[model samples]
Target: MKKSIYRLIKFSILPLLFICYAIYITGKNTGDFYKRFSSPQQNSLILGSSRAASMNPEIIDQIIHSKYPNAKLYNYAFTWAHSPYGPKYLESIEKKIKPDTKDGVFIVTVEPTALMVDKNKPDDPQYYTENDKSVAKTSMVATNPNLEYLLESYDFSITNEFNKKIRPEKNPMIEVSVLDNGQVHGKVIKRFSTEKRKEVNAEKMAELKNRINELKISPTRLEYLSKTIDFLKQHGKVMVVRMPVSKVPYDIENSAVADFDKIILDITESKKVPYINYNNYPNNYQWVDEVHLEPEFMDKFSAVIAKDLVH
Candidate 1:
């Protein structure tokens, strides 16, 4: 009996220690937003999906600083499902803005899908979708990190950790390193030929075009977005923008959601917020994928955004 008890303790303790070690290594790279939640001190915030993640806050600030010398921009963007309607956006707002934050600028970039029901997944239990729940969990951990967060950081395989240590690749999914100003350098790791991607997307457009009413802009999202705008307005000016994508994907988006721009315009006009659709801008920019901007173009894009904000 003593031998049996000793064996149990030996087995349990070893596994526990291993798990603790895994968590420690995995937790090392929790991304930038998680790091910022501890003390989210900033003057300007750029909020949106993956496209917004590609923005360089440092470049945007440099371009705008001449006009507002003290201005700062923090890119607080996550990937899919981090929509304005979601709890992540609200939680981030709560974390980033304090009662004393009297003056700031809130730039919100919108993707059509952000307002449309995904129809591909369960919608209840807010911020608990598979893709976003872990991210939201990770970000919330920043407020008060604990053992659970440590566990959440653990990957089942140590090989993944080993590979990273041996050859650290900037996580193609989320920026591995974030600057103090919350600038994330998300890179475009892969791309498909524009014509080929467009051809593939055309079929997707057909499916969506038929489901317009079923997948129409979510009223619930609009309501929450308005709430976010109202909250930001009390603290600072608000700007709504639709970032640029390639022409083919842009056309497909239009086909998928009719009058999408009109709806956005109505909302912005009602709220008296400035709205810019960079799609309408000259097609001088380049794309890494059908939807994301190339890194080289970000500086020029940031300059354009700065000019728009200043005006």
Candidate 2:
């Protein structure tokens, strides 16, 4: 038994030693990825779920460069992000994250889910793990291949970029439908790109909407929405805008969104921030389905967001 125990320790030590060695050797990459990724620039910053990421940063940067000239842009967009996640991420990196050195403008798209969540999920601890853990090495991902293991092992919230590998394998959350010249048009399809997800999303969002309606929770979905607004109060100037959606998805979810509008009005009123509910705007025939932008509309939509709050 003593010999066996010693052998076990010896074997375990090798892997542990290797991990430490990997970190020590390639610490720069891990250190830099986290610092650079989290550090905010002086221009504008965009955050949210797919919508923010789905919108092209290239075009946004270009426009900011042209208009603001000195504006620095950073893509802090995270996939599968919700309210609590956004607020938490901002707070965690607030000091490191800056929005336009000269101007204090931040644009964050609001989704209906931002208000309500189960408040319990694997992604929760997952985000905590990634952000909480010290990532001081660059080749960390390389040595610790299987990012999924790193995620589950550390229970890191999928909210942080580290868990990106575990993102749904099907449809990417965001994509560019039209990229012409310097303008970009992006689209948000469902999570799973499989034919099954594609076929069922319309129905799925409908059913999901119904289930939530039965619960009759306020737009905060429990407390996420309220918490989010409260958290953003100190993060410079904030604009929480609800992007346009098609009639099908909008109508089904309008009641909840109406409640959301009230919450937005309340937050903006108290915080002196701007919140635009764009559902009142006419649909430009660019919505591919009920919840996404067609190729043509994204550019116009991106420009609208830029024009409205970017100053």
Q: Rate the local accuracy (lDDT) of all candidates.
A: 0.65, 0.50
Q: Looking at candidate 1, what is the lDDT of residue 123?
A: 52
lDDT of 2: 0.50
lDDT of 2 by residue, 1-311 (tens): 99999999999998888665543332222312232222323344565555554565555556655555654445444433222243354453343344324443466677665444443333342333224332311223223233433433333332333223346336566644222111223445545556755577667677757655643323323244445445544544567778788776777666665676776677677767788878887756554545667655666777777776557
Tell me the tens digit of each residue's lDDT in model 1 across 63-100. Answer: 77776665577777666464444555665565666556
- The TM-score of predicted model 1 comes to 0.73
Which candidate number would show the highest lDDT if scored against the true structure? 1
Q: Which ten-residue region of model 2 has the weakest summed lDDT?
A: 133-142
Model 2 misses residue 268 by how many Å?
Answer: 0.7
lDDT at residue 88 of model 2 (Cα atoms): 50
